[model samples]
Target: MSDNASFPHGPRWFAQPGTARTWRCASAPRQVRDFHAALTGYSPTPLTELPSLATELRIGRVFVKDESCRLGLPAFKALGASWAVHRALAERAANGERRGRVTLVTATDGNHGRAVARMAHLLGQGAHVFVPRGVHRQAVAAIAAERAEVTEVPGNYDDAVRLAAEAAAGPDAVLVQDTAWPGYERIPGWIVEGYSTLCAEIDEQLAAAGVAEGPDLVSIPVGVGSLAQAVVTHYRSRPSGHAPALLSVEPDAAACVLRSLVLGRPVTVETGETTMAGLNCGTPSSIAWPYLRGGLDAAVAVRDADSARAAGDLAALGVASGPCGAASLAGLRAALSGPDAGERRTALGLGPSSVAVLLSTEGTAANPRTVTDE
Candidate 1:
């Protein structure tokens, strides 16, 4: 982890200059959503506008894309995991592969494993999920409830990822990871493609609400950067002039994406302990690096206290959010109040007329007490 004493208890912002106005890849394929819509509980999540929050922040408008109840799961991971599983199976069938028993394997801090397990169960296949030490017990139990074999590793998320990759080396095992490495880009790419559903929903919902223009800013939490990459690609690929300035948020302890952007390449760092478990990743996904490099206008790293405060604030607004879910808002607050606020606000085009969308990526999956009606 970087020296926290330097960026203690606040936000550290980094601006990426010369970001491209267009995406390097094609638009998300419709078949991804087509596959998911046929499944049970396939509906768009909520795009809630919080006028009070907007007033408090002094922003033009504040929109929160809530993913708390996506696909009967507590988080948005189902969108990526389920879609990746379907694509993997479809690829097998395309090659005239024999229909044998298959098992999906991957590592997670919590939500992605549960999602993979659920998808595997739905597909009548087996799932083996690896979780790191200090993962919330509720999340592990949820994955086990799906009848997936759960293994607890002694180290952090990266260690579990290594073990899961080893387990997936078998012929009957398929790895459905959101992070990509050498020769492992295809599945992760499909996983990112799956997240397009959320972006598409946001577009339609905003249009339905009579908002002719898309948001001026989009804030997303980064783990391995897949979801952020999806958001960037979705807006940039739009035919309309709605390419919102992108903001990537990460834990101060594990700001690999920010560090990578600073170094002009991928750089791994040791992720220290963080309350936002879902965002504690030591490295950015190889597949997501290029898109993020080209699309993100700015990045910010926030402390655990920031996330906790944001969660409480959302709770006061009647939205249930875990720390990781509220991290984007935390980053937004940090960016607006930090020392570089003027430059960052100007660079991202944030102002009184600038509408911003913050993605609440999950619900209170682990700590039920974190959610409050007050």
Candidate 2:
């Protein structure tokens, strides 16, 4: 694994005026939750409250939404991948299409491909997963375990995405990608919709814990910004006026969303290699850009070393997190300890009374290097 200490950790703060008052509720959350529950055997993941960590961070409370084992998978990708695949198959069946054996294709660094492959195998369909260079051997084996055809691209994740798009050009092949471009927005939108389930679960868990008003701050990891977009949409759509200060976290090596926010438009970055493999995205998803641009309160790009340290921190808290999963905690710690900590905290509304929620997106199963005490 590469040491990421030399990378940039400059945190950016953006406050969008009238954003909290402008958002309106859309009737999609209930439908999304119902769909997942009825078909996917969905159950809410644990929202664990860590008092010790909260005391250490000097916050009122800290909740970690453990998505490591979502739907029997070691990551949260199954929530989106299963829903997208089902939606695609349902659409095909609605059109009276009788393509013999449907095939699903997508590009992923690791987790999403395995989820897509699992969904395809469950639905009695074929799957083709394209992974970028430098992907871990365990991840490739996991995808192949689902009987999906795994293809390793020679270049980066963006190159794998392009190759997957080319491979899915056939009539019988459906591309269940989580990121969107020009003509491929619908499925990705559905993928975002699928992630609404996690936010809904969080809300219920918070209420059950006697905090009915919801969290004041939320830290989420961004790949193509799909999951962060989902978080924004869910919170903004609530009638309870629960607009948490959204914090978007990403690896410094591939901080496409951060770069896009800085440029004031969607732009691709170089996306160099990082230990946060699941977040090694070069570009932001077109479908997610608008929400992220308007709803994000702050964005931070953390080095791989920060994430490695964060994984160890989470492990000490009894939470098994990978580098990508622990990036939210890394960003939080960065915000609280960086040179501009005072200004950043004031700008983000972080204080003694603030309740924060961190999304631990995946478990430390594939990447054993992230489990060290270093």
Best by lDDT: 1
TM-score winner: 1
Model 2 C-alpha lDDT per residue in residues 186-248, reported as the tens digit of each score = 999888888888988998999999889999889999999999989988877767665788889
lDDT: worst 10-residue window of model 1: 365-374
Q: For each candidate in the order shown, give its overall lDDT on alpha carbons.
A: 0.85, 0.83
Candidate RMSDs in Å, in order, are: 3.3, 4.2
Instruction: For candidate 2, give the lDDT of residue 81.
Output: 89
In model 1, pairs of residues that clash are: none
Error of 1 at 341 (Å): 1.7
Per-residue lDDT for 359 in model 2? Answer: 97
- Please give the TM-score that candidate 2 achieves against the real structure: 0.92
Q: Give the runs in model 1 whose Cα sits over 4 Å from its true position.
A: 1-11, 22-24, 366-374
The list of candidate 2 runs beyond 4 A from truth reads 1-29, 366-374
